[model samples]
Target: MSTTGFDYTITRTLDAPADRVWAAWTVADEYAVWASAEEVVLDVRPGGAWSSVMVIPGGARVPLTGGYVEVVENKRLVMGMNVPGRDEPVLMTLDLTADGERTQISLSQTFDTAEDRDQAEQGSNFLLDSLTTHLAAA
Candidate 1:
């Protein structure tokens, strides 16, 4: 984990290829399996919309919507997240690089306030852990 300015970043080296990791981010079905959400809807291109209903523990549902700001196949994806109760959208960037058979996924989420950034870190970490588990089971 790292931070600079108003951004919080997390990086993980996964035992999966970059392409597979890209698919998990871009494809709704693949994403649903590991996204810590009940459903995922993603168009996956620049300017496309990304939305999901997260089913947190105890069955509480949280809906989140966002749009893709940039997309680079198998490499990078930048999203503008429209979080509920927030006036501004947070920008998240996922940078992937191949490390032999594995891939390094770097996630940077920039928010307008430190409180917002801190609030998201735990959930972000859990989702990454879920992704790792999902890949291990594949």
Candidate 2:
């Protein structure tokens, strides 16, 4: 299989169709509603910015923001995320597919270190869980 410095890929199926799932990602209001468990905002277009304030236990909050690099309708999305004092930004890619009754989503990310990759995988899994919860309500 293809590999990056440290590969991180997460795949899941949503009960919704690909188009509907894509909608949630592309619509700022819709995204904030389902994609996050805390304060979040998305610009929803290429070169647009996004930010989210995620509150952890003990009331600690972490904030992340970035700009979308590419957005392919119902298929692919790529974004560059801000990370502290790094020579390069973190990149995230979403590959999506629609089956008859479900949407299959895969997120691929590369990191500079194995630790960084693991951390991102953990955070992304949580975010995906939150996204699932949001879609369940739709």
Candidate 3:
């Protein structure tokens, strides 16, 4: 999408180091666990591609595809996400900042409309919560 700016932004602090949190996000196996995906393939680098198949509530599989626009290990990631049913891909940015033993994550995403942004915010929150649970168990 040719969006001018990010439409939604959310931040959360995880009780783990930046490297640990970064691994959870970039490692395919770790991501699949927290994301509840049936399969995941992540190529975490600039110009790299990633894809996942998520099993929804009714056991329906939804495929997510994306390409990395920017990548900075343990620091930041920018991706162009090809969301289903959308005409254009959404631009998503994740920034990680370390604070002693904790890592603060800020996620920003662009959507075509306010409603879409609001909906995405809810989904993002759920995913972040799952990440927290996954880290706690690690």
Candidate 4:
């Protein structure tokens, strides 16, 4: 079996409603609590820019910056996230769906190279897990 090309998706059921879960992605305060896990200044509107510095498990702070390509009010989001050493930005799209008392959040990322895509999937899913934990805590 050969794994070629790069496409990854992480879906999490949040205890919060779609609105609250969406807020975690849209607002500055809540976005910091999860995605970056540190100080994050989010500009969520279409064409807006955002950045974050996250404290890793070993106390290292990784800086991430991105721009919002699309924002569909509480429903969908498309962003371009950049890794410091990479030239091409990874493209991401998140779909928020309401499921009874919970929200089903799906995060999808596409990368230029298979390695970059695989690496991004492995790393970013951890952040999504952290997001679930943060939202559940709140």
lDDT of each: 0.87, 0.82, 0.89, 0.81
Choose the strongest candidate by lDDT: 3
TM-score of each candidate structure, all chains considered together: 0.91, 0.86, 0.91, 0.85
Q: Please give, for residues 51-129, the per-residue lDDT of candidate 2 as tens digits.
A: 8876665887788788899988899889888888976678899989989768999998988699988998998898788
Q: lDDT (0-100) at residue 90 of candidate 4?
A: 65
Query: On a 0 to 100 scale, what is the lDDT of residue 134 in model 3?
Result: 93
Which sequence of candidate numbers ranks them by lDDT, best first? 3, 1, 2, 4
Off by over 4 Å in 4: 1-4, 84-87
Query: How many clashes show up per model?
Result: 0, 0, 0, 0
| TM value for model 3 | 0.91
Clash list (residue pairs), candidate 2:
none
- Per-residue lDDT tens digits for candidate 1, residues 1-138, read 224557778999999999999998888988988887766889888889988998888988999899999999999999988867878677888999998879999888866678877887877899899999999899
Error of 4 at 111 (Å): 1.7
Comparing 1 and 3 on lDDT, the stronger one: 3
Pairs in clash, predicted candidate 4: none
